[model samples]
Structure formats: structure tokens, C-alpha cells
Target: MDLRRIKDWTLLPGASIEVRQQGRGVWSGLVDAVTADGEILWVIDPSGQRRLFEKAEFYEAWAIEERDGFHYEVTKNDDNLQKVS
Candidate 1:
């Protein structure tokens, strides 16, 4: 999987996203913005708290939809995974 392409996806404001932090909990929220260089992301949780995350902080991130919930399917291999959305 080309993680760079995933990171570069144009996540518009109000887009739903789920991020799994390394060795920590997961967070799901509406995307506030993705930095123009695709290095940082700002998300607003349901409680209205805004959080910032750098690309390396999370192990996985998925762009979600309100209707189907999650946009992609993940296939895992030895120490690797691919996302098919």
C-alpha cells in the first residue's frame, strides 16, 4: 500500500475520519482540515473538541461515511496491510 497516497487524499472539512493512535485509543471525528502539504490533520470530535495529529502518530486512519460507516476494507499480511476503498 502506498501510504503517501492515503495521506495525500484531500480530506475536506466535515469529512468523517477514524484514527487509531499507536499504543493508545482510537478517535473518530469530523475533519477540520488536512494541511496543504499533507503532514498534519485537524479533527473535531463529537463533543466539539478539536485535536491535531501528525501523520506518524496514528497506525491507521480511515475516511468514513455516515451511511456505511467505514469506507474501506483492510487486508492484512505479514507485518503489512492494504486498504481497498
Candidate 2:
């Protein structure tokens, strides 16, 4: 996810997200808040559990309106997040 490409969405307090970690099941949640420098995101899952994740940990995320059977892949390389769809 290029910071420029997804920054707006991630900053929205209520934006919904779906995250997948390597070898782990997917996690879904709502964005609670974002750090001032935009390096970390605070999310609250459906169970009301809060978690903090570095921007790079997000392998996939998209807004609810854009989730109509669409998929995204986020990867980090050379300190940049790249999003492939």
C-alpha cells in the first residue's frame, strides 16, 4: 500500500479493514485512530479488541465500498509499501 495511495483511507476513524498475517487467519476491523506521523494504525475489531499495527504489517486493506469481490496485496520493499491488486 503506497503511503500516498492509502493514507486518506487509513486516516478515516471509521474506515473498515481486512488484514491477513502470514500463516494466520484474516482479521477484520474498523480504524480507531492513526498516529500523527501516519506510521501506525489503531484498530478495533468486531469483538471490541484494540490492536496497534505498523503500517507495514498490513498486507491487505480496502474501504468497504471497494470490497466488492476485489482483492489487494500489500508488501513492503525498500521501506515502501506496495499495493498490488
Candidate 3:
């Protein structure tokens, strides 16, 4: 929601976030780790893969879908989407 919150959240392992790609839209995944350079390493466990994202590549915090596995969905306050608050 905010920079401090994002930074605090992105610091936690296993925390999920939504990453918006240039043309692919949004993707959800768990935070696997954070690099010293402030890059975030995320894992899509269902796909059993991890990817790195820099701060400039980020969009916003995501709402998690918890079922058989975890999935991420982008949040939009304007659209009244669900959020952790």
C-alpha cells in the first residue's frame, strides 16, 4: 500500500506479492528471498519456480489465494478489490 509497508513486507520470507509485467499483466508468487541490492526473489510454488524482480519492476502488494496452493492476485483500491487491511 505504501513504500515502507512494501519494503517491510517484501522483507518477509514466504510473503506473496503481485508482479506486473510489461505485456503479461500481473503475476502472483511467494517471496523466496531479497537480494542485497533490494531485488526480490519470488517463487510460484505450484510451478515450482523462482524469479527475481527489482523494485522498478514492481507494481503493488497482492491478495493471496490459499487453497491447494498459494496464488497471487493484484489489488486495486479504486476497483474495491480485497486487501489485507
TM-score per prediction, in order, is: 0.60, 0.52, 0.48
Candidate 3 minimal-lDDT segment of 10 residues: 1-10
Q: Which number leads on TM-score?
A: 1
Residue 2 accuracy (lDDT) in model 1: 34
Which candidate's lDDT is highest? 1
For each candidate in the order shown, give its overall lDDT on alpha carbons: 0.60, 0.59, 0.50
lDDT of 3 by residue, 22-75 (tens): 524355667777665555555564576766566566544343433223333446
Best first by TM-score, ranked: 1, 2, 3
Clashing pairs in 1: none
lDDT of 2 at 36: 76
> Which portions of model 1 miss their true places by more than 4 Å?
1-6, 23-25, 66-85
Per-residue alpha-carbon lDDT of candidate 1 for residues 33-69, written as tens digits (9 for 90 to 100):
8778766888899999998878775544555653232
In every candidate, how many clashes are there? 0, 1, 0
Q: Worst ten-residue run, lDDT, model 2?
A: 1-10
- Per-residue C-alpha lDDT of model 2 across residues 8-48, encoded as one tens digit per residue: 44344676775545524366688798777766777789999
Arranged by lDDT with the best first, the candidates are 1, 2, 3
**Candidate 1 vs 3: which has more lDDT:** 1
